[model samples]
Target: PVRPLWAAAATAPPAGAEWVWKATNDVLNDLYAVLRFEVQRGPLSRSPSAVSHANQVYPKLMPFLRWWKQQPDRPPLYYATLDVKGAFDSIPHQKLLEVIRPLLREEDGYLKCPYSRWCGKTGKARTVYGVVTKERFGDVEAVRERGRRLGHGRGSFAVFMDLVEYRLLSRTQLLALLTRHICSHV
Candidate 1:
């Protein structure tokens, strides 16, 4: 089970806020370790076979195939793509909290996220606390700085290029590309 960072810090209460910060670091490290393990285990397979068969084909055909097998007449093949502008940014904090609250284990004043693997042992899991005052795009500088600090390969320039490409293509253009190529064709 996950322990609240505040609780760990409070064990040596005289150490004050710094203890809390240390506990947070410990929790985050634990989470990162789990992520790293999963990535290394090949479970996050990004190969062409995995991506094409598992991600694209399965999601696209599963529901349609199920429905078609149950029906008497052959249904026409049709598809539609949806575009939600600023999908993550549009979510209200209270609503987001409502969705997340059920997954939390509450004790005293602090909350522990029991559902997240950050609760793992091995002294790797660490947690950080912060408030979201605005959308992620509104705090681009902080995001860039954190990414740079972490030495994550994808930098601000790469992110900007992706955003530019996304803006250049409409939903129709994306759908056209999807329909024009099969897994082998691509």
Candidate 2:
């Protein structure tokens, strides 16, 4: 049997949140964990689309560099790196739950059926979220078009884009993203 949820406990005040909530993944439970592994025995791995890590770098970065170098009009290149700080935690609890609720045991196949003959009435979780839509909520060109419609000149948008590009390049990187041909093995 696997526990659906357990209140792990709250955190101390001032330093962290007054009561930080933690969700648990019960993937280690013996019965279903074994079944899950057996079902996936030696198959090709599938990655979660929304989750990414260091392993994705080599395949993308190396190919991109090769393509960029081969380009006839490629500009002076400066490698820039940016990582969203605490990105997952920055997601609203309601938004995260919104993504999860529809995929619960009854709705999604990966989640095991609760019981074979268990046809019972249960309330699906609900949370109210206030959403606001703004104009120009996308790419630089779209934003520039919005500004133009509101009568800001082309120069304004160009300057805005330049500032954005400047800030990205000037931000401190975790590792200096300089190109070097040091092929030493780890």
Candidate No. with top TM-score: 2
- Candidate 1 Cα misplacement greater than 4 A, ranges: 1-65, 68-88, 105-186
Question: Please, what are the lDDT tens digits per residue for candidate 2 over residues 36-103?
Answer: 32223323124222113467667756776787789999899765322222212345544533433322
Worst 10-residue lDDT window for candidate 1 reads: 107-116
Error in Å for residue 47 of model 1? 25
Each prediction's RMSD to truth: 22.1, 23.6
lDDT of 1 by residue, 1-186 (tens): 432334343366464234544433232332223223233334434533233223576765676578777898886865432111111244553453343333222211121111111322332333232211122335646544433333332221112111321112222333333333212122
Error of 2 at 145 (Å): 52
List runs of model 2 lying over 4 Å from the truth.
1-52, 65-88, 100-108, 111-186
| Candidate 2 Cα lDDT to native | 0.30
The TM-score that candidate 2 achieves is 0.21
* lDDT, residue 5, model 2: 45
| Shift in Å, residue 99, candidate 1 | 0.6
Q: What count of clashes does model 1 give?
A: 11
